[model samples]
Target chain A: MSITSFIPPQRTLMGPGPSDIYPQVLQALSRPTIGHLDPLFIKMMDELKQLLQYAFQTKNTFTIAVSAPGSAGMEACFVNLVEAGDKVLVCRNGVFGDRMRENVERCGGIAIMVDNAWGEPVSPALVEQALQTDPDIKIVAFVHAETSTGALSDAKTLAEIARKYDCLTIVDAVTSLGGVPLLVDEWQLDAVYSGSQKCLSCVPGLSPLTFSEQAIAKIQQRKTPVQSWFLDQSLVLGYWSGEGKRSYHHTAPVNSLYALHEALVLLHNEGLEQAWQRHHRAHLELKTGLEALGIQFVVEEAYRLPQLNAVYIPEGIDDAAVRSTLLERYNLEIGAGLGTLAGKAWRIGLMGYAARNENVALCLKALESTLK
Target chain B: MSITSFIPPQRTLMGPGPSDIYPQVLQALSRPTIGHLDPLFIKMMDELKQLLQYAFQTKNTFTIAVSAPGSAGMEACFVNLVEAGDKVLVCRNGVFGDRMRENVERCGGIAIMVDNAWGEPVSPALVEQALQTDPDIKIVAFVHAETSTGALSDAKTLAEIARKYDCLTIVDAVTSLGGVPLLVDEWQLDAVYSGSQKCLSCVPGLSPLTFSEQAIAKIQQRKTPVQSWFLDQSLVLGYWSGEGKRSYHHTAPVNSLYALHEALVLLHNEGLEQAWQRHHRAHLELKTGLEALGIQFVVEEAYRLPQLNAVYIPEGIDDAAVRSTLLERYNLEIGAGLGTLAGKAWRIGLMGYAARNENVALCLKALESTLK
Candidate 1:
């Protein structure tokens, strides 16, 4: 039983998530682990919620980080809001949207899926049609940035349409939050969830989430109990909200939360607009280089996500062979296509700390050789 | 908007959990984050499962870490095993047991609670009687070690009793797993969940869970969909099992899993029994010092957990003042009481890497000075 400590190889993480974490964030993670209920930890939590709110651009009082990953954050929204027999309109454009439909079904809600093409952004017109056709719909759910296809939907327009039809909105900002422009409060996004790993430049765990007053009202008036105890936002609110001694819910991934705090702090230091522009600039550089190489983007240029670039693989390129060669030879990792795009497209991410000119140049250099 | 990076103070952790993480584990946590589907990461995942199996003392193929805290692991067992309308017998000796009843109720199961006094072990006689009274009970759930009260229940005997009644057993080994002797396979415990931050000496956020074949069978035969999309064992199994090409569920907490792998590796190096003895030896030293200072244990001596010692505060002692002084003056951290024990007792934990003679002596000395 002489097992030595696992020393993971350092690779350039240019995938959909588990994005390149900042050195400060990694150092924060290695800090002395503290009791979840320690007073200083609670104070830090308060600052974290504030930092998350700044990133989310929301004044939602219920803003906090779930101790799990983005999927749990997605589940938290569905399980807490979608009670049995409730009708929800889910827009399906990529893998995450399909996961949303599954979440609805598992929560015992009736999902009316508005289907869009795999690489296309979710259409507000289609969602409006679904809402107009089904007046019983209680919620409108869609992915802001579809990680699988690099499509960025117009969340503001979608939220506006849902509000016009008297339905709450749940936005999956997992790949959007710090990487793109997302004004949660202005959009009136009722419930929003994002991953720390994608745009926050933190380790993969802990989902930053916020619920508008309307969403809180919906949760408060839920007819049926939330299916999962760990995700019950009503109970979790007691632990995350209010002043003075917060109630204990589950153990907050103390170290991960610390890393998230630091990541968000970095985001704040960089300024949200600069961060978004940095991602866009880096994306432009990578996109131009890839275009010169005869690569085509899966998503249309107008709707393509700045942080996640989904490019089609050349007909003769072996997907696994190319990716493995890149990993082994250059120590670089780009995401393989997910779901319907599998074997057809590649996803190269320019997320958070990884959205730099140096990273973009390295990726292009690596790809130029790998393609030859 | 001017938020500096969070630099957490270094405190000697003597709490119920997030217990003084091993330096190796912390280093592992700060390792370069990898893609969840990275081949090397997958190889590490297999090793993690094997280490977890060894720690669980089970060869259950379903042993893996849930990318959340222990509370979610507890919910996973209840939501996956106790279907809607099923009757589950929950033994409530402390806060965690009551949390089990909540999980059962949230899962839409009828909870037949066998109440034991707080600060006491779950009585086998009462559990047996509950089983006799409730023939419809499909599952039995209890805490192996109650964190709130420092009481350790006999999981082996309890599992035997549940099996004798033809009921599946769900054990909460959150504060027990790496600290005490828990034979999952030998006791026929159907489902078990543990925290990484406890005696595992890892950073918090991940839950190590294992399910026996019988439990897997029950989950597979479930009539209704598991209430949680993220926690549905059937889907999670796809990601954790098989030889190659693991399916995508959620992005695993890559670095946290790295830390857990290192923690379990450390445990394997020390040997589980030796780790348990270290906790016991440290607890005895702490107990003697505490007793000499006129402090008494909240739990009875025979039933107390070695890792978590719930000791009553001496008369005229102010809990907050003493804890604050320790943190400020000596950079030591101890736990405050929880639930009914709140304001009345202090929980002094001797767990995993924190279970050392130096730590024990330091804690006693800090308390001696703080009390003065």
Candidate 2:
């Protein structure tokens, strides 16, 4: 039980996330632990904000990680911006969108639902119709990459539609950022939240969030105070804001930030376009192999996310048994279907460092053997 | 921009939490990413809960980590347990205790402040006096080890007093859990929250929380629903209850839990009594060395926490400059004074893996060099 120095086995991560962490990111994580408010670490925080902005593809000055998980980032957005009695349209196509509705209701906002089938993308037309009916809706939220079903919605078109209706848009890019194309500025998205473990290949703790100036303006104009003080952006900005006079918020997961920096730097080096291409390439390779093994995708070809592929479980195949076999026999890991798709589908993620040729081959072979 | 996979320079980590991570903990963190709800991962979760119970020295069945940092753990305890109009007594002696007041007020509870000076323990006599004055108080809250000021309160006495007054106790043991002698069962504590980083020596993110049966029953019988859905134990328990049928909560930070599990295993290997003795031994050694160097501890010796020592800055010396020089020159990290003690003291942490003879020596030598 006295732990010796670590020697990590090289893994081919094709699960939801934490995808295979880059060796460099791991090294960054093991660096010296410094105070969250230390000047050197604060300097790193500034660089992190800049890197997050680049990854988010936004010029918004408020881009930073909430010192918790993607769920907290989602909570921070809703608690600060959604005041009581505000009508918010939550487009539920998967688990994360439903979480958005929960956030809205918890914040005392009236949740106006726009339901889409679980495996399908969020229909821009449905969102538009909801907005037309609820003209007073303040926020329209949807998932960009629905991890549950590997569906990619039209976030750009949805944001444009929200703009047309004069409602702000909140996009959950938890599974999409860095792996796919996300044009926050071009799409005119107001608020977006992402997880580090997904496409970013960083340790999971800090969640990256970005807000447009208009979103900040809305937060400032809120009448009722945000319910959670730790998540209130008005105060959190004091710590994450790079200016010399940073106030104390909760301690930023300091070492976690280092992992994020290294991940973002890795993304930049690969280039956004190349990163997107890499995911698509890996996805196609995985798809071809799985298809050859008689697997059918849950989401249709056009709407499928390259990073996460939800596939139907073959008839008579026990989902739990297959997954257990994969883990015990091959040390392979993949996601189970969530919500409506539970027991009927499997989610295979090709993300960040996990999206490699070898990972695709290993997953397919292990899954094939388990199915047999 | 690619990471070089450089090895870490072994240093004596004698700072705040995120102290030195054990090598095994890092290896666990680098383990293959598995689905959050994978059966094997669920098995790991169950083991983690048991390990947390051992670390907490409790038989509470409701022990689990809030999938966030210590701040979110504080928020979870307050938001779930304290409803609107609930009168809660909060003892404020340091930064974290003040944070509890913020959480109480944010959750719409009336905060009855039991004030204590910074660097001082919460006066039990004062708390008893307040309880007598406000007999309707529902919750009594205080920090066990004040990380910011290094003041350790008498949690056993405080919990007993709260129980006598028929009020639930919410204890913050963020800095005390593994490093100090804690008796959750013996103390009959109700709701306790702790950090993974502090004495646990895990990376930051997970916050271990335990609720006594009474606390759980109160939460179950609450008239008003917990406002924050993410922190609601009712919903979260379904995911972490370790039952055969586990529900999916928001994706748990997978690898961080692995690191925590390893840290707990390491602690279990070195029995809790031995761990406590190690912290005490290191504290005694550190105190002797600091006194030799003409330094003074802020708290009285009788009330001092073994893991965290707050030393007053010498008059006319730039406290920030010395810390900056130490960090920049020797790559040594230490905490600065917070709140009322800002610019007046430095918090030196002898936490978990950082609690060793060599770290104490390094800290003292580094201080001497910085002063010179």
Candidate 3:
């Protein structure tokens, strides 16, 4: 029943997420708690929305953070936009893409799946073929940055394909948002969801979501009400949308939002382009170091995400054992490949604060020693 | 868009739900982020479950924190247990109880509501009467602490009533868990949900939940699958149960869970009896101080919640002005009444670390000075 004060070891977090948190973001987490509806807090909320729009490179008014993780962001987007019996085209190239199919099915939407190789990016050509087969598809869903494999799909190309088929787009930018380029408006992405912890360098909890005006129109025109009342955007907007007369959807996680606001501020401070370049630089350094150690990346260079590098595990090395030793001895963290790639690869993240020269150097040196 | 670092003012929070956070809890929030499924993190998760069970006074195998807020916990409980067309008797005393009804309706369950006054405890007799009238009621739902109006319902009596009527119980102890004594096993409560911010003094995000053997059995025996794939207890338990091969759920908020673990540890360290006594002592002291300032409590003394005190807006006094002045001049926070009691009463909370002689004295002094 007793516990020790958490004295966290200084781990070089090169995992898919909760990639190393910036010290400023940590300080933001410790700010004094405030009422969610406090005027000052509400002001911060408005600013947060604008900053998110900047990060997403969109001007949509519906941009806001869901009071849950990125998975709930997936749920919220589907539950609010897709009503019963609607046909949704879900393209799966990784675990998160499959999760999109699950969301579609759970929303009572008929899912038309377009499959792609596990570590490869979603094939726009395959998706176009699926659209041709299922012209009735109302929505097209895919993961832009597939966390399970360090693959970056051509989100713009996929959105264009969906547009040609007259289907709305639901893009998962959970691992891509601040670390890479995202053009929500330019790509005409209908609904996009991202997580705070991944590239935002915030504490995990809030999921930033932005819906194009077209998606809002779809939600408003739904024949049946949203099945999950808690996630029903219509009602939730009353709480998160306007000023002065905000309705209570639920008690907003007040302090968590503060941390998010601070994270977004940090993002703005660094500039999105700068953050992206930082990730790319870190990944290049890590890749060079890792290749020197005879490690091969699972994802092809053209489609690979700079933030998350999927390296093939060396033969005769136990994936779990190596990870455990690094955690126990070196306090270094790297992600294991998910699903089909499990036991064959390690996902070394270069995201946010984790996407730095020092962390990359530390991970390579520690990994080298651990491998030896 | 530019944003200043969100510098939270050092305020003495006496709000309805986010009762002031402890400094230790704030420090915990700033701890380094870790992977949700890391071995050390999973070890911490196991310890957290034990601490939560102690706070909830339950030995249920299904006790763990949901990755989202208390509302998600509420949704998880209803979505997982009450399948489509299940007859659920929802007892409404305040905002949260109404939320349960919304959850039931959303999940396609028929909600038979037993409504009560906002500032009064849920009448056990009324719930019993409703259950008797509706024999098909599979679950009876109620809130232990009506945060909107500082009312304390007889959760034990209601659970017993539900048992007599052959219905399972789902209790919302969101604001009662660590502040008031919640005997989950003694009452034979089927499912219970709570928040981290209220009495736990942790940064808000994680929702602690416990389900008895009976609830788990019901989940297993349900004819239809749970509506929400995200909240399905079967899948979630595979992750939080810490037994066998752990299936991955959504990425858990790693640092927030650390904060919760620390809060629970703090609670158990103080011991439940002493925690309850501390709340009672602070409430009594606050009451005496407020009485000296000529304020009247909204709820009947016998049914008043020690953690949340709803006081009437005195004649000839401007409630908004008083609160504003308190915030501007004294850096203090107190909640405005919600729902029917909105603008009519002021909610003063003294919960967890906030339920101390120092906080009580400070809040009382601030109120007195502001009134003058």
Candidate 4:
């Protein structure tokens, strides 16, 4: 049973996540591993928090990365913010929103799901109406950018309604943080979570998270202990925060944090607005090419996410065969539709370093040839 | 706020965990990122499972790495196996055992603790006595090697007692795997969790876990849903297993897994018994040097872990000053004591790649100069 070292093929990632990592970020990941409690590593953590604050456009001091993936980040927010018997209005437009509902229910919170069509943006009016109907709802949760459908909800508008109803908002910014406009402070978002694998273009293990003052208050006043010891942000805060002698929680993924730090540094250098513009421009190029190929997008132009383009599979086209051809023949990857859109739609990503004209061109040519 | 790319100083890590990583493992981490759902990535995952099984010395088909760190892996084992009303006999000898108790309570299980001295190994006789007294106890949980105190508990004897009482066992092999003799199948450990950072010398972030069929059966027959959506082993099993189409759970930490795979391959190549012997030899060399310097070990000679050596700080020597000097002057890092031993002892690790004659000599020379 001798297994040799694995050497993976280099493929252009146009999938929903784990987009092309910058060379510097990859180099950072291979850098020397240090102790989690090391002073230098802690200094890096403080900088990472500040960079995450900049990316989310939030002054929230609670911004930090979860040691796990985006899903754990989502769980951290829910378990900390939503106590038992709390009513959370979960706006479900795509897979992530449904996941939010699952998180709420698992935390013993009642999930009042406000449903929307698969590729449609979460309607602010519907959220308002739901909140008005259920004044008992203490939190309103929604995905700012649905990676499952390429639909971008109006987070600012939705957050405004949540605030108007006197409810704290939990936002899934997993696919939107760097690719689109997501102002946590401006939107008054109480709890927000994003993925390192998405627009950050870092590797896929860590989850960047932030909590507003109100969110912190809710957690502080909670009667029940957070069910998950690992995801409990209260205990985690002691480790990530304080001046000197931070408490030890779990071991921080040292090298992964380095990769995230470099990725965030790159983001800081490019400027958030410029990065968003680049994603949009890449989307436009891919859109034009797909239009020439007679492929139709699942989402409307007004609400589609620039980084993630979910398009309907061409009629009579075999979904698996085309994706396999693209992977095997062209060494390219495009995401298959999830949940309700499965086998019918394909998600093409242009995120972070992958949000470039070269990637768009390669993906277009690969799809065109594969479809033929 | 202007922040540049973080360039970490190269330091020799001789801490309790996140010990010196193999250069090849670090190189593996820098490899290009791939989509979590890529077929090639899935193939690598399959090989990774085999490598983990080899490290664990088990044929339990349920072995896989948890996406989070070792603490999360501990939570996964408890949440899946112990239900709300179940009675779990938690043996507390060091920091990790107390953490195990916390996990048990958080999972809604009643924790009946069997206490031992901080620097002492868990007594198998006491474990048998506790099981005899509590007929309702469903599981017995203990740490094989306590990183905090450098004590190696008798896992085989404890497992024998647990099975005699018709109970399953949850063993913390975080600091034991690869550094010492841990026979999972032979001891019949029901649920075992380990960290990549410890004896494996991989980067921190991933936890390699395995469950015997008995443990799996208990999880499968559980009355309540596992509290954590992210840490739920049942849901994660779908993603890690099956022949053709693997389900997507969370986006796996791709690069970390690559490093773990390479680390495990190296371990397999070295042979587990040979690795264990190497750690012991390194420990003896370190012990001889420390004794010459008039430093004393915290744990007794018979039960001390070869990987983690907790030593008393020499009289009048400032703990932080010595550690800081080691870091600043020699570019070396050793662990400060945790929990009960804090401020009194220093934990010097000789695990995996760090268990070498050169590292021992360098650490000894650094400590001697720092003390002076």
Candidate 5:
């Protein structure tokens, strides 16, 4: 019970998330605490919304950060959009998709799961079939980038299909938002949510969420009050939106928002396309280096996420042993496969600030030495 | 929208919550971002739970910080303990109590609100009457310290009455936790939630939550799933609990937890009773100063919360102007009254790190100058 001051070790974070946080964002987090309704904080909120809009590639005015993590952001989309007795088509390929189904069920919505194997993208054909089979489906939900398996689904195509079927689409862009090309406006995504910790490389906790007019309409016209009041976008709108005075919902995570603002600022400084390309380049370099070490990627090349690479644990090499050696020896953190892929895979992340030549080179050299 | 870097002004935060965070906590927040599942981070997680337990004075193994604000923590308690069709007695005195009713209803539970006037404490007699009138009430919920009105309810007596009525007690300790006396184990409270920003003096995001064995039993035996997956305590326990390897749930707010840990560590170093006395002394000094300036407190002395002082604006004085002048001139941030009391009163906080002689003296001195 004698706990003292914890000075956490500085590590090169290449885990699923939080990826390497830029110094600017980390510094922003320690900024003086401001009242949530302070005029200056309100101004910052307005700019944060715009920055998120830029990152999400959407003109949706309903864009704001949820006061919790990405999982809560995912829940906010489902609980607010999917009312009781509503039928939702949830595409389940990995952990996050399965989580979407859980959200749907928890909200008393009937979830019609469109299943795909782990390490594989959700089949657009299968999703269309599910939507067709359940003609009364109100929402089509799927993860765009599955962190649990490093699989990137065709969000643009899936969103297009959902729109064709007149179903509101909910996309989990947690790992993909700043790393991949996602046009919320062009793809017509009804609701999109992302983690701050991913390619944005901010601290975890704040979840950036955006809802199109269609999704906002559904939330506004909900048959029942939103199940979670803290996450209800309608109420949240009072605080995050304004031409003059912003209203109070819950206390906005002021310092965390500062971190997000700085993260988004960094992303804005480096154009979104350039950040995405950097992630892709880093992924290729890591891919080349890992392949030379006889490691195999679980996700097929086309389906893989550039920010997160899930590779098979070398045959007969212990999962915990290898990860332990890397963490202890190199001060580097890579993800262990989660859910069904646990022990079978390791996720090497190259995200935001971590998506650089030096980080990739260090990871390669470290792995080479650790394996030897 | 060309937004430049946000360099926030350093103000002395004297708001309802987020009352001047400790420098140590702020520095802890800027510590390097680490993997949520990193072994060292997990070790910190275990220590955080223990620190929370000490703060709560509870042996309940389910204690943990919700990765959101107090509002989400409030929702977590309701959504987990309550099932659809369950009857709960909610006490409404101020803003937070009304929110409890919202949570109960959102969870599909029937809320029997025992209303009290604003700025008044929750009536134990009324709560007992409601419980007796409706024996089917499975839970009795109330706020220990009402932030909006600076009223402290008789949580211990209410808990005792609830126990007599065979109902589990759900207490909101958001503003009361590190400022007032709360004996979770001795009082036999079932569930309690607090905010890090309040008396804890941490940056405003994380919510420290603890559930008694009775509440845990209720959650485990529930027939229905917790509505919000992110707030679901059952699933979260797997992530926060464990002897060695913790399971992955949502990514715990890595850096926010660091801030909370430091805040709690600060609390532990300062004896809890000594901290409460400090807040009381500061409140008395502020109150005396305010009274001398003809400012009337909203709550009576007996029911007043030492941490939050709710005082009415003097006759014909513009609320916004005074607050603005204080902010612009003195770099001091005070809270505007919320909900029913909005524009009528200003809340002066003397909690955690802000509960110091100098802060109170400075606040009084600043008010004198601003009013003149």
Candidate 6:
């Protein structure tokens, strides 16, 4: 088989995640890969933790990137916090929330799911009720921003309710971390995880994760070892922790970390609040344009995530046909609906570097022309 | 914390893994980010699989890269095959073998370990003896090439022994793939995993893995769900499988895959056997130079890995000081010994792109000056 070098076509990514990456981040990714245990690389890791802490708006020292994707970060949180027979109240609003339940089950933990409609936010009241009904529920888990449906839950309120019930909270901030306000410390989120490809606008693969002292304490007190050795936070702590000389765990994805560092630097320079507002402003523009074209959004305005806009496919309009046309003709990528909304909706993302006036206009124009 | 952009200093990497990456591979990594589901990206993914199959010298349809590092790939093999209460025969020749035992125990499988001395190859006779003693052993696991001690085990003979006992095999080819003759299909190996960073000379996140049909059948017949949801190969198979349409398991590390594709392409272009010979030739050059400098090799020549050279530090020489001097003055990175050999040995790697005459000369010259 004669296989040559693969040259990927450049496209405007308006998908549910993996939004347009900053040019600098891409450049950083191409930099020379150094030894993961090199002193210089270790120094960069420390800086990366600080940058992630700033982005998550937390003082949690356990903040570091998992070497895999967002799902692994989700798995890391559950496998480390939930032990065998431990009852966890998982709020299932969208795909990620359901994934949390799977993580819990795989870790041998009992999941008490609080179901919500696909296009709606996780109800804080329902979560509170579940925890109250099952006082044995040791941890509460929910997605802060559902990438599947563009729904944003009230993470602070949900976390507060979990705290009131004396339960630790695990938050999936994959789509919310940089595009919206995610005050991990203020919300008292014990465990939170996100993807680098989402609002962070870095390449996919690395998962930015943070854990509170309570979460670390729970891990330290585990009766059984974490099922997945790659995800076990107790062991990973030795490598990421700055207390002593860094120990060899696995080879850190050196270049990906470089991209994440550059992306975080851009976010810090832009200012977190400013970046969130930029996403919101772009969403408003896109919403107005879509409304003018008679397209309707899936989630209500109040609970909608600015970065991820899920809109119902108009009646009699073929979903695949429209997305295909946009991809082929315009070199634009708008996500197909996932899970429950597979054929009924389309997810248009305005995340990080993709959250710009030009991208919004291009997407609106492309959709209008394609529909016509 | 005002952390600006992290500019990593370029160093000549002579480490056990994360050896010098090819420049083209680095360029491929920085390409504009694309969606994981982008049709173009999927095409690249298919090509990547073919390239990996060529490198491993296997036509196993189950070949794919694990989203994490080599350690995670090891976890995937054990978690999918060895169920709770299943008996596994693990051979401990170096650090990775003991890690395999950890993986087995974490999966609730009983590991009957056959101990071999560090810096020595795993004895196929001992493995046959262990499997013979434990008729119930479902699998035999060993590292084909030990990065810790630079010992190259006889994978072909060991796999033959395992098959003779009606057992599957798990081989860690992290430091062997693309650097030596790893005939996966010819040897009838069941399951094997490798690191992209090692001999492949790609960046360090992804793990190239291949599983024989027998291994897949065993996974399909598992009594319980794979303990780690992230590493559950059965689920990942849907994403990597070239069936109707690729399902989303997790966002593939898009850019890292690009780098791997390019690295594998370079390997294919050079011919796998040619690449192996290059590594061997570089090792000879390095060996002559190190011997001239009064250094001693840790592993005997018969079973030593050409890609990884573990050598003893001279008496009265401070281990850290020499390495530090090499780093600071020469901008070169050499690996300190790991596990049992730590502080007593230095590992100089000649893998993939780093396995060249120029690199050997630089490493030898750097070592000579630092020792002086």
| CAPRI level of candidate 3 | medium
Please identify model 4 stretches exceeding 4 Å from their true place: none
Candidate topping DockQ? 6
Tell me the tens digit of each residue's lDDT in model 4 across A337-372.
999999999999999999999999999998888888
Which ranges of candidate 5 are over 4 A from the true structure? none
Q: How high is the lDDT of residue A106 in model 3?
A: 85
lDDT of every predicted structure (CA atoms):
0.92, 0.86, 0.88, 0.93, 0.91, 0.93
In model 2, chain B matches the true chain B with a TM-score of 0.97
Clashing pairs in 2: none
Tens-digit lDDT string for candidate 6 (B175-292):
9999999999999999999999988899999999999999999998989999888999989989988777889889999989999999999999999989999999999999999999
Tell me what TM-score chain A of model 3 achieves: 0.98
Per-residue lDDT over B1-372 for candidate 2, one digit per residue giving the tens place of the 0 to 100 score = 233222334444566666777777876776655666666677788888888899999999999998888888888899888999999999999888889999998888999999999889999999999999989898999999999889999999998899889999999999999999889999998889999888988877779999999899989888877888778889999999866688866778777788888899899998899999999999999999889878899999989999999999887889888987877777777887888888998889999988888788888899988887
lDDT of 3 by residue, B1-372 (tens): 557887767877788767788888888878888787777788888898888889999889899998888988998889888988899999898888888998999889999999998888999889878887879998999999988888999988999999998889999999999988899999899999999889888877778999989899999998977767778889899998778667788888888888898888888888999999999999999999999999999999999999999999888888889889888888778888888888889999898888989988888898888788
Cα lDDT tens digits, model 6, A1-372, are 888888878899999878899999998888888889888899999999999999999999999999999999999999899988999999998888889999999888899999999999998888888887989998999999999999999999998899898999999999999999999998899999999999999999999999999999988898888888899888898999887799888889999999999999999999999999999999999999999999999999999999999999999999999999999999999999999999999999999999999999999999999999
Q: List the residue pairs that clash in candidate 1.
A: none
Clash totals for all models, in order?
Answer: 0, 0, 0, 0, 0, 0
Candidate 2 per-residue lDDT, tens place, A242-313, comes to 776789777667667788888988888788999999999999999999999899999999999999999999
Minimal lDDT window, size 10, model 2 chain A: A1-10
Worst lDDT window (10 residues) for model 1 chain B? Answer: B1-10
* Candidate 4 lDDT: 0.93
Please write out the lDDT profile of model 1 over residues B203-260, one tens digit for every residue.
8898999999999999989888887889988899999985768999999999999999
Q: List per-candidate RMSD values in Å.
A: 1.1, 2.5, 1.5, 0.8, 1.1, 0.8
Residue-wise lDDT of candidate 3 within A210-272, one digit each (tens)? 999999999999888787876788888888785666777777877778888888888888899
Listed for every candidate in order, the interface RMSD values in angstroms are 0.9, 4.1, 1.3, 0.8, 0.8, 0.8
Predicted complex 6: CAPRI docking category: high
Alpha-carbon error at A65 in model 5, in Å?
Answer: 0.5
Model 4 residue B259 CA deviation in Å: 0.5
Q: What is the lDDT of candidate 3?
A: 0.88
Candidate 3 vs candidate 5: the lDDT winner is 5
DockQ of each: 0.85, 0.40, 0.70, 0.85, 0.84, 0.87
Residue-wise C-alpha lDDT for candidate 5, range A86-177, written one tens digit per residue: 99999999999889999999888999999999999999999888888878997899999999999999988998898888898999999999
